[model samples]
Target chain A: MATTSIARPQAGVRPEGGGLLHRLFGRQPAGYLFLLPWLVGFLGLTLGPALASLYLSFTDYNLLESPNWVGAANYVRIATADPRFVAAMRVTLLYVVLSVPLKLVFALLVAMAFNRGLKGLPLYRAIFYLPSLLGSSVAIAVLWRQLFAGDGLVNMALWQLFGIEGPSWISNPRYSLYTLVILSVWQFGSPMIIFLAGLRQIPVDMYEAANLDGASKMRQFFKITLPLLTPVIFFNAVIQTIDAFKAFTPAFIISDGQGGPVNSTLFYTLYLYQEGFGFFRMGYASALAWILVVIIGAFTAFSFLSARYWVHYDE
Target chain B: MTSSAAAIPAIHQPAERRALWRSILIHALLIGASILMLYPLLWMLSGSVRPQDEIFGSSSLLPSSISFDGFVRGWSGLQVSFGKFFLNSLIIAVLATIGNVVGCSITAFAFARLDFRGRNFWFALMLGTLMLPYHVTLIPQYILFLQIGWVNTFLPLIVPKYLATDAFFIFLMVQFFRGIPRELDEAAMMDGCSPWRIYWKIMLPLSLPVLATAAIFSFIWTWDDFFGPLIYLNDINTYTIQLGLRSFVDSTGQSDWSGLFAMSTLSLIPVFLFFLFFQRLLIEGIATTGLKR
Candidate 1:
């Protein structure tokens, strides 16, 4: 799908070398007309702000004053002096590394269960997906905060089920971030749906062939299904990694926007937001934003580069 | 099915029974897991009806004596009525949905069907924008809107949709439009149909599934969006439902837990209804986007 989409424009490239001006101003003016909204948005909203942010990263703008040139000072300060920045980065990296893999594993397991052609599979899928639909909302985050409180339902369950007293999950510094990670893992429905589709796409004949060789079900999965499903896994990993980095709402709402209890839940985006909006350190925040872009870009590039070894595409 | 049953020997009954047992065990596990998964939501629903003091006091999902007090107090809200917030969210969500559906479809039509110079470049640029973190654009976009006096208005939240700033929807529509047979456009063109007519009559009608998908997503995302309203709209009068809920938590130990849960349950109704009605399209959209190959 990726290769075919990239190859499409090449097919449209004219063989004959038309004049540069002619090629520049094609006959299809209506195409440009159709593209008017996106073009204006691209320049005015996206590209314009993007360029402004790049410049803002090097300045000391506080939104109250004019931006002053301070070449790399914000970046240096963040790298050298900012404890909260480091904490936020550490928190976010831990979140991505922990939540994403756990979520993906759970998603794959559920998808495999659903792929067994369960009756009322649609109903189950919807039931499982309900959390994801509500997961990012302020309401859910608020609910989550209460649910993990000392006297909340989770602790109540812990006491009733095992006679063990549970601590306040949201208040304790050690457990606060894990609560958010659990929230993330609960919303694994999107990836589960994606995995289900990928599982469906695997040829049934391959499984049958494995069965004819007297391979066990686990062996069939390991030898046949896993290899075929690697591409989807890689795709989900890259997307989820980026998503986990940008996570904000849960942490923000759960910690009441302070990243409370020693900054355990201070996601990178939340910290960036605090610097930019809450503290009015717009330039520092812009620098943080650029760093995030670089980090996400690096992860994406790394996944794509490593994909060649593991992600299989059938010819 | 009959042939398979006939081919199996009558002595294979124990094996079939064992398969049945396995199936029963799987179902039991799934049912148990589903209950655990749905418990929080159910507990929230029950808590909404429970008395204020009884909410956290008892962990039981069933309220011994249910009351409408939470709903009444929550609806009345702290300073402003929840109705106003709901209206604010609805207006923004509806406008954003319409803007995304119309603008994204048109942009996608141009990219997928119309031939023009720099088309590929623009398309690639649009795709690249998908990878750009919203944080990267956050400060500058806020500053831009602030300078333009759109800070305290819905314009910051809604206008971008009209300008097709959501490249994800545009990309989805593009993929959908590409799947549509080009011969339809050719056939229409041969019959004296203009590009506008082709778009309005053929593409728009044929692309209903994707358009509906985009519209539903736009509505849900906008309705649930807290950060945009948090940054843009400061006035409580103009606050969305999310902001209203946030305001309920004073963060100094005086949160209206019962009222918050009531309002939260109310807030989820539209989304729940939408999901129930459009489950197939929603699932298909997620599946097709991820597993296009």
Candidate 2:
């Protein structure tokens, strides 16, 4: 996606003076040296591990064994036998489908509301954004569990007011997933802030003109604001979908690393966590990882391919 | 577009009942929405401080009497120490910021300014890699660290940051670098200043806003990261604050409600302070990233 984003600018370019070494080393090797730390990390950390994982996916390498090649066996087992993998996939898909749209709409509404006048707007911005800061913290996830716990806050409120019982929300398989959905929605600040910027970019002059023409606020928003904001909306949709799929901390922390309450909250990344670190099924985990990469890649490509109709950019 | 005079006969003053009531209604609705946005956080803060017995008592959003023991008890657990975990977070956060700011800027400089072979291909590769979810590579990466005997150490936590493994910062820096005029680099070069000198003397100084943006982001993300530390730091001795909080969950099959709640309150302080300190930049950076071309 980023490659295609950059492709337009690269072409026959002007050459620098002297030689490659001279350009690199001329007055100072300072830039290269400045980048030394990260360069070391890339060579030693990222690229090295990335390739290692690809190789590990083909080997039956539990921690106890020296990785023996077992071509496609890990893939076959995952595809054929793993009920948990299917469950995790279902949970993750539900999570992404439910959370991303809700988050986008909430963000859009908050952004629209924030775009207009409000006294102490910065304070409102800070308050709305606090959840994103708290997000994925074990503390927050723990708090979420409590908030939804049967005898906890949510139930206590319900029982007190309505004289009715509330089920074990976080522990009940029926409602456990709501906690994850709520967690994602609560952290809507990033997208909300993005939407706010997108809102600001829609020319105020257009709204002013629409008002002059006697268009109702409802009509103006639908006809003018929404159309122009499609690009930003598209961007948020793609990014949020990717983020929703990769969400781990809250699920792992909330489910107590068990994928729990009958695997109701067995999010994909959490399941990946289980296979890799918990069970030490490193090979299976790597296969899971590659599948995730492919899934994310395909969806990202899909969004970009579709974006030409929506995302507007000025030259 | 209709003329202002024709659309609103009276431009400066409010119309009688029509506009006035609607404006009042909208503002009231906005305030109601804002209150809803805030209620959850308000409840969490109150719950973290309430006595264990009183916690579920009436689901109070605000405690009648604020107790301080939660903060005290939360801050006091574990031999590894919250202060040490704090320092660990501090060291990792600060170093990661430095790595991101300096390293990403230099690389961004290469992508935005230099005319090197494979530059476009490499930039494209870097961007393409952004879509690669880290979960797939996580286990193998952990194993590599385990093999290298770097697990249970801060190296795994803090080292990859030194390498431009974080693509977003690099992309952000590249955009900022692109926004900067190339004449500055050319003028410096004409004076026999090397490309490296040009970056330091010219680019770095000018890119302060974007660099601060990158640094602030890296700090927040690193401070909050749990997955990285969860996998790498097996020993409680080397745990960062986030890892320390995970221990609050307790493995004895019984949740320590009071202690955990107390610790949650305590865990929030540094993060709260960090957020407050950089609030302006935090909003500005996020808002700017959204407004990207």
Candidate 3:
């Protein structure tokens, strides 16, 4: 936790004065040696590919052919002519907007309940967390499709309880994305765990003091708990937003890998996959990939910029 | 003492009763929510045991007549047996987990214990990669692997792990490593231990919880990964459990619904069992990662 201090241990002892080469290499050769694997990966796997994608964004590369330089044509096309790109953006944004807030709210509420110290709390927490662990699996996505099928369990429940026949939640365009949002919210365990940790970190004396001073439970939560938990909330917000933007498997599986039923669940990542692998439009997919990075970066930057106003970090 | 207690009994009795009622309400609510949360999983289990016709025909939690046909057919898989896919997944997951544990811990130790030129700068760069979307690196990495003839093999998935491509685990381990008191390392150094010896004998042994956390996550993620294998592996023989499951449904129309459910249940068993045994470590891993920062 106290990383900054640990990293500055050598500051306490001055190195003997030496030539430039000695000073550079002699002080910590083993440190760099230990870091060799990550350094190689950072260059070859991450940075190299990342930069190559930027170059590929302006090209016309298919797997079958050598990449031909196009110089901004891909970006121009996405900006102007690509209706599916716009649809994908719209769908993805709608998803991020709908799912992130809903998921965080559910996570916070459930976390608060669990923080109440009910008996068998560990069992409850583990059971609640089971979904998030399995949520991304193709198996679960397949199960989700079956559950929301026209004659599936969900529809059966609707018929039995409300005498209303439910539409095929996966097939219908209007409600298809909503089903994915529900799925996202259902897997709120990760954030709920974080929130529980944050709740535990809040000093108990603050609550007791507030209670003694005639503060109601609701007032205490608003005045003390919520403010103290803002940092955790902010962290979850950024991570979940990025995660929602990158969401693919559920939509891909639910739509049977086509992003189908008239592109209702065509998440941006799924569309990028289709463009890259399915259509062999590698350059276009690369461009789409950069756009996703930019969009996520912007969202993250905005959250951080806004965080100073609300996030209360202890001094 | 008896006289005073008897005099106050009437006053405290109602309060004690109210507390009992409150506890009962809380337990009742929690139990209800737990059932709702677990319903989908239960349904899948029941569906896997039920006959094919009754899967979608009935909404009941229990089957009227339980059958093992789904399990038998599902294990036979579409082209290869499901056992092969499970083995494939296990091999890849285990290798990746070992790679992550070894590589990430080494990297994290350097970050946590050593002071070097541009250390903070390098650390910042590593954290920056965490925020960079994976899609940004997807195409070029594919092309790189394709050029090296690593495509359609497990190398693409397994190699990066050996290089500690997952910065999240490194960050987690670094935090855990930093929490270990510097006195231990200093004392080892005083006893003429080299950095390597300190890392091997002291740091690694002390950092087991974080390492376990990283290993477990690495295994589960690799085992469940679909997009990575789907893009890289064109051959059915190289399919992981996820890719195998995907093959159960024909994208155009038909699916072996019962068989799919049965196999899906089977696929989840490993993860479920792991979680059941190591729930404490898993929860601690997540909690520590989130709260430490």
Candidate 4:
């Protein structure tokens, strides 16, 4: 369908019967005209800045002074000497490793449950999706801090229900990052919705066949549903992983924009913000940014490569 | 079901009873989970109305005695009123939505309908930009804006939308516009209508669903954005609600819990309202493309 729609224009181009130069520049000026805003933005905002940042990454530019070229010094320092860089990487990696799988698991479970021909499915789905809508807001981040405070609701519930004392989870470095992990998991609604859509696409006759063959629900799920859902699972996994890497607001707000509680919540983006805007280390921040780009690019490449081994396609 | 049940009453009775029990169990579990998910927001809402002394150490969603004191205090808690922050956020979000809808749809129209040289190449490039992270471009864009003296103004936040920098919307609109049949454009062209007129009169009307989806998302994202406004709009008078809420955290410092809750609840109202009014569209958008808020 996509290919046909994209190729339809080719026939239109041939029918115009213009010379190559005329076809390129004269025949359909309206196409370029309509695309003007996006073209300008792509060049100025995205491509230009990307190249400029790559150049800045090799320099020692501070905001007040003109850039002084330093030829990979920033990358070398990051590779060797920067302790906070290591810490930030550790925090971000742990976050990505922990949050993505947990969120996906929760999302898959809830989606499967919802997919079971339940009554009031729309109401249930909306209730589940509310968090994903509101979770990234500053209000939610603030509410999270209060929820995990020593005297806050979680501790209060712990004491009242179980007679156990709960520490301030947000302020305890030992547990601070875990709070953020839980927060990430709490917003599993978006992935759950995607999974629901994917599950809906699976043919029901397959399930009926399994049931007639004396297979239990568990066996059918494992043998049929899991195999068919791999593509959606892979999609959710990659998108969630990239998003987890770029997570900034909750950590920044929760840690008071310092990534504190002994740097436990020092998300990579938060650290980048600190370096760029806090210390005015524009060059160092650009280096950090490029490293992030490399890490994300590498991860995306790895995922696409590995997807061939696991991702199931009907074709 | 009744005819089969009558033929095998003994077997059917147990199965029916078991199914009922299972249904009950599932509903019970779902309702329990729903409560767990909504508890925190309800908590904040309740906290906002409670008196100051009663705000902490209470997990109940009921206020001891409802009071407007928190709202009054929070509205004027900082140097600039929360109303100003809200107005700032609204201006930015509304302008961004208009810019995105107008800018992206036209770009998508060209890509999906027009026959142009290098169309496929440019389309591929546009899709590639969808995956690129904003961090790499952050510093240099900031430098560009700073050099042009766009810093400390809303220009940095709003101008990019008019230039259609958000490739996600463009990609989304492209997918939608492609689904629009070419026969309609051909028919319109036979009547001597220009492409622009056809887009304005036919495509835009037919594509309201996608446009609304893009507009709603654009508004919500711009309203919820913190980093852009945080870096660009430093002045207190120019802060968005996210920045205002952050500064409220900084200035209050446990001095006013109820006030903080009040403002936080207020900050989420616009987004919550959007969700309520556009629930179906939002869900369909995410289901189709996995759009993030």
Candidate 5:
């Protein structure tokens, strides 16, 4: 939503010309009245807690006693000694790097396919979008664990068709993160819909011109479609990267909430959960949370900064 | 039948054939992809109904003999019945959805139509919250709720909604509200209607589509939420469907695969039904805001 100026009574003037209270409070008591709920929420739920967490990140509080300030001790320990923190960072980075691009590419390809005036477009879209709707649900996460088990459907097909055995993917450290990656890719529908919307906004005359110039379909896609679609791509990239970093349920469910099998699927959020709730190391978890915020902030900032070079905008 | 006419038809035949072939190929590709995408879900459905011995025995979708034994066992297999879990989920989802719609609409009206001191500052702050990861505040909020003796209650899950903590819905509504011509509010004001009357009588009624979008999404999100319940709701009696499902796995420990599958299938039914009924609104909502889920 754009933040455009709205009609307002002039400062120091009241429409009804009331007492001193009207001028002191400005001419829009009704505005603050309507904004009361959100103001309360922002202060109470978001801003207050956020600042509290930042303070707690520098202290040691296990919920049993008052927080004792450690002054960067927690951050030092994480950077130097904590193996699980390192593992979590490695796993989460791998997941973000592997998942976001693959998901976006798949979304773009499917969006392109659907943009060709395909028959049954709605049906195809609904089918594709179903997974994303159900993706974060524990039910789907449960189903995912089964699908990658040793005697699961994947291995069953492998043995029956190709005469090869497959690993119990979720239990294998080598393949566990890959299963989560595939799961992330499977829910590519949301980005696809956004991409489709972006695709529709591209003028058809551009395609007609390319067609008349003897451009091949592949050339037209790389030359016209990709450039025009960069804004949507950037949007999807940032959103999906942030989402992937925060991914929890699949790793939690599939790992039996342990982030096990050598901690391969120990996502940063999972590790934070383990520290915060599981172990009651509230201070450590607060530190972890702030680190995640910085990481995500850096990513978003990087995307926005890099966008100027590659993300084409008409305006 | 001149030679030129014969050549024209001949030239058109191969092109038409090629177009037909391309369409067939595209349809085949799409159909293949769709089936692959749907196969796991279909498998889960079939697995729930099939005989226990046949679940891991074959990868085929068809079950030679089907039974509802899984549903029968899974429904009451837990300490608390699945029905109770469903009711708990329904209550939380409904309450959360109502809170989000009502709270977000009024807040949006203020941001969209009203003018106040520090309006720009607050509005920018509100947008900034959209980018802040929930984890940053989650621990402190958990601690706050714990201090208030709301650790295991649905209040921890649903109360923030009433306070308009979900800024996405407010943003969505603000966008939608901006599209409704300010003339409607101006016309109502000319009748000496207060801003409250304008918001109540004019803005909201015109915002049904966006409201429905917010409602459907909030309901689905609340229903699908696992972390909230996992963190705050510890009692089995108070557990939502998501917690129930996860506990079903933990308690069953691979002994009741079919039961797990059965309840999993049951848990997805509400979300699936919502999608089937409101697919267009849901898709358009995502497209408009680029919101994931």
Candidate 6:
């Protein structure tokens, strides 16, 4: 950022350009014109609500009645006394750690396989990508429920092959969490597609040179491919982490919206949702929502800081 | 169907005698992985038609007997008619798509091409919004709608879309517009075309491929969004398909598994058919959009 400014301005190429300065500083109305819609929404909708929500967080505002400010009571209650919040935080943290890493690994592996010279590659790409298309589908969630049922196909097949019995994966606290993780891994298609596109950008000459030097495929991938793919991988990592935190629908549906069977799959958003919407603890829910925002913001900042170590953007 | 042969295991074409086993080994691994991935979806389809009480008891890939009752029940049994639910989804999705393609393209063109004031600051603000976690604003937006008495109507869903609630679409369109040569806009303006006319005549037509991509993504997004509809619409009569699906589970004691799966399969029909019909456009759009980026 610093180098570009010195070089470009010295070359007499202003970032704002020459002699149309009225428009440049937003001195004129045109600046406001382009932002009219969003400005209205931000001020009238986003800002007002945002402030109200922050205020509401300090109070006990159920939807039906006026809020009574409880100072830091809600926070104290949630942090120390609320067992559900602890359970939810534990489940949510485990889910994020397991699913995000697994999905990234699977995505990279599938992307590498597709990047090679394969027959009917586009067809392969499309088929592999179909899971992402079906990712949030209500049908897929419903299907997942039955597939892991006590006497469902999974167990029936298990009986035939190994004569083993299967537990109700969705209902059993032990297995429900695994089911969510696997479901997340199934939707690894988007990151895979992104990786495939990123892979294609890497010049084939790099690989050819590596191969001719008696490097094995594995060595070429680690040395040449991994370094070049770092930026794309980091981008996917951040996006997937944020997404993992917000993952609600699948867990909601599979758990039958109760987040139950011993609160094993009681994801953070689910509890926040139940509190805010189901119980009408609107104020408490808002506090929960803002805490999430803070957590997400902190993680995003941490990832950006951590990127200097691993992320290799060409610029 | 034709690809099933390739998925079969334990058999492989021989290479030179020494390398034959290695070739077979690779094929075996590849085929095994493909089947493991594909089996769940195939089972889901089969389970959807399996008769009640027998859905779980069966061990076979194919159902012992098929019944359309599940589809019938799923379609007819909801608090809101599934037809109305589908229509509600269709309306929101179509309107959202139209707003995205038309509105975002025009805005993107203005930002990329026109010598507009405050453009950079406003553009920066637009980009910054993309980073804002949506839930931070979700409650307030709900309150705003509730105060305005627009909660139950589709207005909450459709109106803001036209007002450009989504910045991703706008940014995507901006990238495409920036890639186009500036000469066309200049030529159109030289021919005495107004800026809006230039946008319509030159940019819009040239951006059809991207417009299609924006439209299709908007459709898919709005169709799948349960949260938006669930928040805005209180009355059961106004429920979208996703809302109906969730409520169906809530309202029932014993879930009609076959019916649920049947509806799911049938619902896929529209999206599947849409993709089948526009696959050429979809892929070309996706591939080029990714490449140009």
State which candidate has the highest DockQ: 5
DockQ of each: 0.49, 0.43, 0.51, 0.57, 0.59, 0.25
TM-score of each: 0.94, 0.90, 0.94, 0.96, 0.96, 0.88
Between candidates 2 and 4, the one scoring higher on TM-score is 4
lDDT of 5 at A30: 72
| Ranked by DockQ, top first | 5, 4, 3, 1, 2, 6
Docking class of 3: medium
List all candidate RMSDs to the true structure: 4.7, 5.6, 3.9, 3.3, 3.2, 7.3
Q: Among the candidates, what TM-score does chain A have in each?
A: 0.92, 0.89, 0.92, 0.93, 0.94, 0.89
Error of 4 at A163 (Å): 1.3
- Candidate maximizing lDDT: 5
In the range B92-150, model 3's lDDT, one tens digit per residue, is 89998999999899999989987667778889999998878899999999988999999
- Ranked by TM-score from best down, the candidates are 5, 4, 1, 3, 2, 6
What class would a CAPRI assessor give candidate 4's docking?
Answer: medium
- The residue-by-residue lDDT of candidate 5 on B1-293, one tens digit each, is 67587688788999899989999998999999999999999999999998888888589999889999999999999988999999999999999999999999999999998766678889999999999999999999999999999987899888899999999999999999999998787755555567787888899999999999999999999999999999999989999999999999999877787899999999999999999999999999999888796
What's the C-alpha lDDT at position A18 in model 5? Answer: 61
Q: Judging by TM-score, tell me the better candidate of 5 and 6.
A: 5
lDDT for each candidate structure = 0.86, 0.76, 0.86, 0.91, 0.91, 0.76
- Is model 6 an incorrect, acceptable, medium or high docking prediction? acceptable
- What is the C-alpha lDDT profile of model 4 across B1-293, one tens digit per residue? 66675579787789899999999998999999999999989999999999999977688899879998999999999999999999999999999889989999999998888777788899999999988999999999999999999988889999899988898998888888889898887766655566787779989999999999999999989999998998999999999999999999999987798999999999999999988999999999999998854
Given the true complex, what DockQ would model 4 score?
0.57
lDDT of 1 by residue, B99-194 (tens): 999999999999998877789999999999989988878899999899889988999999999899999989999998999998897666655566
| Candidate 4 off by > 4 Å | A1-23, B1-7
Distance from true location, Cα of A62 in model 4, Å: 0.3
